[model samples]
Target: MRISFSEWTKSGSPWVWLNAGAVAISIIMVVGLLALIAVRGLGHFWPADVIQADYEENGRQRTIIGELVEREMVPAPQLRGAGIEVPEGVEAMARDLIKVGNRDFGSADFIWAMDHFITHTQRPAMLFAAERLEWGNFYGYLREVKEAGQSVGRHTGYEKTQEYLTLWAEFQQRIDRVLDIREQILSIEKKDIGSINYEIERLRLKERSLDLEQSTDTAAYAKIEARRSELNAEYEQLQQRLTDLYQQINRDTFVAEIADGREVEIAVAKIVRAFLPNDMGLAAKIIHYAEKVWEFLSDEPREANTEGGIFPAIFGTVMMVILMSVLVTPFGVIAAVYLREYAKQGFITRLIRIAVNNLAGVPSIVYGVFGLGFFVYFLGGHIDDLFFPEAKPSPTFGTGGLMWASITLALLTVPVVIVATEEGLARIPRAVREGSLALGATKFETLWKVVLPMASPAMMTGVILAIARAAGEVAPLMLVGVVKLAPSLPLDTNYPYLHLDQKFMHLGFHIYDVGFQSPNVEAARPLVYATALLLVVVIALLNFSAIAIRNHLREKYKALEM
Candidate 1:
């Protein structure tokens, strides 16, 4: 079995290349997945053109190419002239006409028209405007118009025109005056306003003092009262002027009327027709679902979404991670110190090491079950009975919530920190501990001041790993704190705030909810992916921060090792 050197090298060379190729492929696949997620998530934030679809009363479709306009500009006369009949109960015909005609109107006017049209029709009308359409869809569009147009009685073209002309002229003049005043205000130094405010406060105090002395000293009160009167007058005048200026600005900026539904339809249809493809695929489906998720989040709180926003989930995750780290760190370090510094290398130590290793291998869901039974019901229930008998049979503390979740995860991660800390403690040279002991240092002092500092980096590494595992954990949290929806944040402006007893949403649960549990699974598919992507990002961020801290600690202790 004599093999030539050349043949041996050739056989080994292929295995080497094969291993290298496998590594390369694995890296590429992971990187590619991350890049795709980032692109999709970032793309969600970019602005898109709104597509509006307009359907005529006769079922004929017309696309509106321009922005929304006011009904006034698209007056009944103009529409009738354009061959469209003015329907009865069309309150703001002219305003609706303008909205249908002008495509360059602001977002506020556009939303107003869409809402008004939707209200009148009692049918869903799509408004394809920028999502950032300021003034919420409800009040921004409809409320302003209803308030502004209250003055003009219901009338057709001629009478309304006369009223508009009179109001417009007066309003424009007032607006101009206000603009001039604003300029003057802006030009005046900050010091001037401050001085005026200061003087007003001073005069107010003087007036109060004069009032108290009015019955005591007539001449003294008269002088103080006169000075107070002058100051009061100046302050009142300045306040009145500022108030007037603000009112004028509001009036000038106010949109009195909005476009009709037909106009919004037309605009949305046109935009949609241009961008949306006839054929949709997996990616499109995902995007559509993502939009639905966003809509759910942005919508006013409702029972359907259950989960209000992702804020509670994010907060719960952070709090649980922090608590777990705090709980595990000291215990792990102390246990590691005892094992490394004091305990003999005997059967008990070996058995404990084997138990720790086995604990790490246990299924996470099993830990969830254990936590629910032991911590939540047994230990926690007893504590709750003693301290909070009012919440009997379901103690607030014993409830499946953030606190129990953290404790459960802390238990799961203890072995990780213990193992790493023991390894780190072992790495500390025997000479260092021996030298400290020789210097009359107590064993605890030697372990703490000399040994622990050296092991900090490894302990940090363990904590980082624990956090990375805990953050993405869905199984353990499922029995603990994770909820489908939470009305308020875990921490809020309430008595004894930071309610760890409350169940909260998590990104992992959101993915599950959207994918399998949602009533509209079809609508929630893309949302599931988006949420999954977010969870991945959050876990990565936690790991990165831990790694950074570990590196810093490593560097600090590396000098000591030298």
Candidate 2:
């Protein structure tokens, strides 16, 4: 059927199609971005075959060993400008990025090599990649195993000799032993010794409080001293035990020959994991991949957050969002109820609404500055002087921490809750309120039972939006509390389990640090994507919980709306 353009416009067919196309394109772009991030991030955990190659550079030849990270064609002119001797008239050059993991020995963790100058590339089944505690990765061939500075056995790669297999078994056994010892040491330091220190600090503060009061309390002084003495005795024992564990952990050593034929002796305790990628079967690879992913999720980050897992960041992000919701809900609901229902319709009420709507549009960083000045400096300073005078000059509450960060985000997002709640209240049919009042219900009773219940879903909708924004925000958190690394979690087994004044890590800040602040750009790039995807997952989870609650409320109140 032939149709005029004017008729199509009148029918709204063109606009409808245009809107549908726009929505489809947006969905596709978002899914593509997430897929790209997932591939790049998740692929980092998969073990790749380590390549050993010979290359000639500046009239010198050397063996280069590494995992092939990326290969690309570069403009020959660009290479020449960088002082590389590219052949004339060559429009493009094939270049490869190799991650040579012996960071302590090499000047750089990654090196760029031209394919033309490279020869004799092979992925030897015996070549192993060692993930270390200090350096990033070490690629080499295991020459021998040693114990107590004496040779125990020599490595025979791929030969599967009886003695060589036994040697590998011994190495694995030692690795397991070292891992167990590491766990014990960590538990002692973080739990046992940590508790003693916390108690000692508390005792000191108690004594200081007595001094400030000028109390003639000799008995109190004696009790404090007795507790300190007990803590000191326990701490000395833990220290000696820690010293012994360190000695045991450092006892075993192994020699590995690198690409340049230099054999370096590394301690067995230093290895995070050692794997022969080429020799790994599919099942073994899958197991190894799962382990790596788990480590990334559950372990403490090391080497400036480029190498380890991000449990702290994940925990902090979730905790902050939860705390923010707790704070913003009551304040936002009360203000919204008063404005929409109780306040007389006037210019002042109208002006307050305009101000609140304007606040939602304010730049997040501006809120950060306001929080720093008002909450951290002015308000928190007064709190410290009044309550924590014994810990003088240290500025406990007068600092950026979890409490201030949560409060700051709450203030920043309260406008959202207010607007949504007011809109929900407005949508309630005037008849509903009149009907409740007609049934001999008071105004307050009508609002509490009828109006607020129906508006719960809308309040949850505001919370969902708030979480989505607050989870991804980095700038405001930096000023308020988020840090590159937090030594201890804010919530722990201390006397006061929840320490609101402590600084914390956030996934958003972790991404920023790994991407921009890292010394190793290529090594950190994968982590950046992985953390980004994790952040998305976390936000989605939070929103999903709120959504579930919202759906339940909607279902429960469906009849009320009718």
Candidate 3:
């Protein structure tokens, strides 16, 4: 039993050093990652130096101030001054600004200034200018200009409209040309088809001749057969020509139609704008998004709302999480109740505990595959057949959607809840349960009224952890509900409002789509980081809220602990 201190220290040396080194590396890696993300994300919000022409009071000369202007608010007087024709409405508005000490130049003027100032001059105005021009108001002004048949200031609204109109007119002209070419192509196809038909007729005649020649002589029959083969070769050539003509016509028509669509052009324009050398800050982007989020929640849904807004994803994620929590909480708590309160310590109980622990360790993607296979294909297929036989091939319940995703995540997180609940149940002193039983309360009542209430904080902690993990998970949702874009929100004006079978988008998935699937990767990169940061913030907020609630509950129940 007498061990030398030196030998014991030497024996324990490796584990201590290994653990210390591992912790150090982990801290370094975490700190490094935080630093990188912070620098990139926060830097995006920082003001860029914009060269703005300020008429300094001390100097008569128009000196350029290297102050920051929001990339959105710098005035583009130059672009407005371009072509020497200002719209009557814009001129009136500008004139009105002079009377009011230029205080009433709303979003239109601001946007015009922003476009021109950012594009032409090296001088930038104050960053606060970008802050003051609300995107909602700016967009509203655009709509107003459109409605009034008035031009927007600088290079934006009316300019965009003119550009679109000019492009559209050009597109129409191109379409007309393409249509003329298509007519020629169609004529060529018709000629080829007619030629093929004539050849077929000639071949039939040759076949008839061959039949007649067969009765006369073998040589005559052979000549008729050769003539039929020549006609068949001509028919094949005509058919190939017809196919080529059809394909050419289709290609021309498709190009012309795409060129004519304004929405498609705008999307392309946005992609181009993203690539240009303009620094759009994080705060500006977020503020822009906040307005969008507000609009999505408040305003009537438009066609474009079906494309990129976060409303559907936000609604779907919240609904799905709520549903999953509802389904999982009772089952997990009940399981934990039975394990900790009712079941005696035995081989079976130990095995159950081991199984629960093992389940928690399984990869979430494996669970996703299981959900797709077992829940979607096997069990869901059976249910669909039994109840929804009319929709046999494509069962609504069996499809990949929000309901299935919720169920899948619920199953994946059940073990965590169960383990946590069991631990919470164990933590309550035996005296509390015993006292309840002594007070003529039934075991079930004691378990519910005393044990469950006290254990709720722990259970909530587990739920929060589960939620944080589930919210950011892209893989499982990808197999289940997550889509690149969903046409409608899961909750809509439809009957039985919550459509569990609907596919959804998520911030995590948005990041993936913007980063990888977008046509313009360079344009989407900043958006990708912004989306990632948003997701991280959301998860943190959720977790923090849950932690706060747990702490509150703990404080409230502190007296019960003794």
Model 3: CA > 4 A from native = 1-35, 38-309
Per-candidate clashes come to: 25, 0, 17
132-233, model 1: which lDDT tens digit per residue?
Answer: 112212111111111222432222231225554454444335445544655555433233444455465555555555564465667766776687677667
**Clashing residue pairs found in predicted model 2:** none
TM-scores for the candidates: 0.58, 0.98, 0.55
Ranking by TM-score: 2, 1, 3
lDDT of 2 by residue, 24-125 (tens): 999999999999999999999999888988899878899999999999999987988898898768999899999998999889999999998897898877
Position 528, candidate 1: lDDT: 58
Q: Where's the lowest-lDDT run of ten residues in candidate 2?
A: 156-165
Per-residue lDDT, model 2, residue 98, is 91
Q: Which candidate leads in lDDT? A: 2
* Superposed Cα deviation of residue 7, candidate 1 (Å): 6.4
Off by over 4 Å in 2: 83-89, 156-162
lDDT (Cα atoms) of all candidates against the true structure: 0.60, 0.92, 0.58
